[model samples]
Target: MNTTEIFLIAMLIIFSLPWLVWRVFNTDYFAPLVVVQIIMGILLGPGVLGKWSPEYYQFVFTPAVVQSLNGIAWWAVMLFVMIAGVELDLAQAWKHRRESGITAGLALGSPLLLGCGAALVLLQFPGWMGPLAQHWQFVLGIGMACAVTALPILILLMEKLEILRHPLGQRILRYASLDDIAIWGVLALILMDWSRIGKQVVFLIAFVLLGWGFRRLMAWLQERDRWYVALIWLAACGFGADWAGLHYMVGAFLAGAIMDAHWFDQDRLDQLRHHVLLVMMPVFFLSTGLRTNWAVGGAEVFAAAALLLFVSVAGKLIGVRIAGRVLGWGPGEASVIGWLLQTKALIMIIFANILLDKQVITSETFTALLLMAVASTMLTVPVVAPRMSAHR
Candidate 1:
């Protein structure tokens, strides 16, 4: 078949197979459609599908076809990340600074330290660190991955539980929002290139000045015009960041972070996010899968994944429990909060993807992180639902 025909075949598989399995088996109670989509991506990746049927994998995921898919995935994820940024309720976080700080700090810090420790162990082995990574970059990159909470996915899960607008749900959003800032801040630090330090510095300064002007422009524009202008801004910021050697994803996040969410109509903004996920994010997941490899051995990758999962889950729970004690949270609150905050789905995958792109971690490490993300996300609803029910 021609490239276009094969690409369509690939798209059909991406959109259909996962939905069929999700609808048929009814995995929503334990695994939502998004989590299932991620799993399917891994299964369809080279590690699994290529190993099982190399010829078919090569035939469909040809170079031309893969390139076309990647373009879609890149734009899709950029839009998603920008929305996550625009939606960050920093004003709410600041209003309850003391509580938010205590919770956010522990939630992020405990996992980071433990994850760094795990990275240390992985460093002792071969095939874990990428070729271009310095020791510190690899360690910090892995550490941050463990600490990441997928704010986008967390919001989705909370909405699923019917708590998104509730007081408790709003509190969780506050904590996650604070951590989201730190997560991207750390990412910029990790992707910092000393050789291009001047360029990065220039980019930051220019972004600040231009960002001010952009915000003013957005403020004066009609709502419909704002949407078009935002896309233009997203593309420009992405290009500037990539040119500065900080990666387009960093620029994408910044593009949304500077804009006030209140500027847009809440309902319309929510719909746009929903549509982006529905239409675009599956391609990103599949593209992520295409990069997975098990050259370090499946058993070894699984072991690493298990190790990361333990630290990520344990660290978040421990840290949150400590915060609960300090703040005198009611009984059962911490467990529910901990489980909800421990989610590491899309954001963690994005973090690992950036690391892999920069060669800070090998495909083997990326595969393990991917597995950890899928498992971690799958555990959230099942574990939190019962606790939430008891409280209700």
Candidate 2:
């Protein structure tokens, strides 16, 4: 068969299988289609399907077909990350600086500390850290992965729970928004290549100047014109960042971060995000899945995943509870907020992917982190739903 035919078959599997499972089992209450899709990606990956039927896997996911799918996935994730950046309401976060800072700090810092400790334990073993990583890089990267909260996924979950527009929901956004900024900052630190430091410095300086002009230009353009201009800007920023030895994903985030979300219609921006997820992100998910491995052993990977999940969930809850006490939050507030903050899916996976790409973490570590992300996300709805009901 032609490469195009094989690629189409891959796409068919990517889109169809997850939706079928979600619908057939009526798993919406616990496992949303997104969650189902992620799980399906793992099941379809080399660790599972490829292991079982290497011939069929190779036939469908030929080198050409994989390359084609990767192109789509790259663009998909770039757009998705850009949208996440565009949605950041820094102004609002600033307005609630005290509360947001306290909450976001503890929420992020606690898990980071705990995850670092976990990474230390894992270091005693082989096959966990990447070949290119230094001890500090590996620890910090894994720590930050645990601390990450997927803002996009959090928004989606909040909307599902019918609290997206509520005051509580707005507050959660503020906390998550602050942490989102920190997540990228830490990512930049992790990606720093000392030999290319000069280029990275130049890129930052140019980014700031260009960003100023770009924002002004965006402000001047009509909403209809801004969309096309934004894509052009996205491509340029991504290229510049990649050239500077910083990842293009960072550049994509910056491209959208500087542009005011108000410049475009909110409904249109939301629709664009939804459409990207519907049409493109499944390809990204599949590509991510294809990278999963269990050379360290499947049981070991699951064990590591469970350990990370424990620290991630416990640390978030503990930190938030501390914040609640210090800030004097009402009863049950911390529990609900903590559970919501613990949700990690797209953003954490993206962070892990970057770590994997940078050779800061091995595929074994990536697989474990991926499992933790999926399991943590699945826990969000079930745990938060009951608490939200009680509050209501």
Candidate 3:
């Protein structure tokens, strides 16, 4: 719609070439690909590019660019969900479902309590959000987002470091998948802006039933190569949730959980991950960096950031360890597995972004949490991956 948008578009295309080239040549530093794209977005964003020549920047920031970039980001998320769904060893995961479920619940619950405990005292702000923040719902959400470990980054780290098949990796993967869903469900509960408990219950029943039926039909059809049928299911799951007052991620996660890919094929899932990471994900990260407003979110945000990062990492590690001990796990084994599973990724980012976009979170909150995620991703991934591999 504006000149600034147009310039950003041209620049994104120009920048994407180098990113794509680098992706093919070397996959060594995939994390930095996200960093680089964000930097590009910031440079082209209001402060630098727009400041230099407002008119020129406006040309770059056209309506077309806005629409296209947003579309690409959405596509990346779909790929992320598909990969997540496809890789799941549902049968194995379900067989160990009790252990997995316990680990997941504790892993989610502990961080949630810790983050909310910190937020109540430290993350104080005034005015409109304060009312919402005062409620347990906001506290629950911020806590969950703060505590999530990135599943995608963990998989990448475990693979690159040659630890994916290790005992520690296996244990962590089993627990993390369960934990990811548990945490998401908790958020879904918080997100259901209903006035009464009965209303919420009704909504859940309708949502789950619709989701189950849709997924069953999808599996039946897709087993027969019916992608057109798959598309209808996708629309139902996605738009259906939008209509029902839930996030698309809920529907997407439900879709993944229900389609229930069997574990006989690992290579196809791996290929799917490769295709998504190489082609589409940079756009998502680009959108992340562009949406972020680091300039205004300075000193105050960092304090909250430090707390969120620490609480998130520590609580999950401790909770998982506690669960392991309860299940008669060895201390060293539990520690390694706990540490390995705590790395967070795209789902975490999207959750935080959703809150931010809904105006439920401040820009400062969003920026700090997101950047902390990037940092935590960098830190925890390398450490646990190597340790897990050696232990195996």
Candidate 4:
């Protein structure tokens, strides 16, 4: 079959499957929104029936499709990041500074610490197929992914539930935002310091100054002028990473952060995010699902994957619970935050991308991680939602 036929079929499944899931499952609990999309991928992916007929996998998940999926996924991620960054209105959460501190510590620190601890332990296992720690950079990348929280989704969920403007809501937003900042810092540091560049401190300062200057320059432009300017500068930053000793994501993130700081309006950014959700984001999720080489499945690997998943969930529960108590939340509230915020999606993509780029983790492992992410997000929201009223 021609590429066009393959692409069209992939598109059909991408658009149709979500609606089908909504129809199939009378409710969205076990068969959640994201899970349905993921299953769409598994249905076409190397996991189940695809193994019998590799031709189907090839037709649907072609290189062209893969590239297109990457494009959509990146845009979805960009919209998600911009939304997360702009909504971090420190002014609104300022009153909850004390409680925010407690929540932030327990919320962010516990996961990060546990993740790092797990990474250290996992490092000893010659090669888990999940990592290729030629350098600690790869190890740190996985650890960072584990530590991250879904801030944008968390905020949207909180707002949907109408707790965003309340005191607990404000505290949760602030705490989550703080966690995002911490996650960004860890991400930046990982991307930045990865190069064994000489004069590392000098490079770090210059990168920040460059980012700052770019932000100021964009802020100085007309709104229409700014998008073009931002586009050009981001292109330049991409080239800068290729030319200099820096990662492309560092430049991409800085570009986003700068716009987030000054030029982009939250409402406008969110509206763009709306387009992203409808098309780009679904393409992205579907792409990841197809790429999930679950043909690498086995009882042994399943055992390993389960251990990793359990450690991830339990560590967050224990660590965040302690952190919640420290942050001034009652045990009940902290337990909820620990369970809810531990939902990992965006980081799954980032880590998978990093491994794919670095050749650190295999396609199979990336797929497994995606499965873990979808499962966590599927479980987190419903479990946390009913409790929203309970907590109140």
lDDT, candidate 1, at 297: 98
- Comparing 1 with 3 on TM-score, the higher-scoring candidate is 1
Tens digits of per-residue lDDT for model 1, 31-144 = 898888999999999999999999999999999999999999999999999999999999999999999999999999999999999999999999999999999999999988
| Candidate 3 CA-lDDT value | 0.65
lDDT of 2: 0.93
lDDT of each: 0.95, 0.93, 0.65, 0.62
RMSD of each: 0.6, 0.7, 4.0, 3.5
User: Which should have the higher lDDT, number 2 or number 3?
Assistant: 2
Error of model 4, residue 378, in angstroms: 1.3
The candidate with the higher TM-score, 2 or 3, is 2
Candidate 2 lDDT tens digits, 38-97: 888888999999999999999999999999999999899999999999999999999989
Output the TM-score of candidate 1.
Answer: 0.99
Q: After TM-score superposition, what is the CA distance of residue 124 in candidate 2 from its true location, in Å?
A: 0.7
- Give the TM-score (vs. native) of candidate 4: 0.82
Per-model TM-score on C-alpha atoms: 0.99, 0.99, 0.82, 0.82
Give the per-residue lDDT of model 4 (tens digit) for 62-90.
Answer: 88867877776765665555445555656
Deviation from truth (RMSD, Å), model 4: 3.5
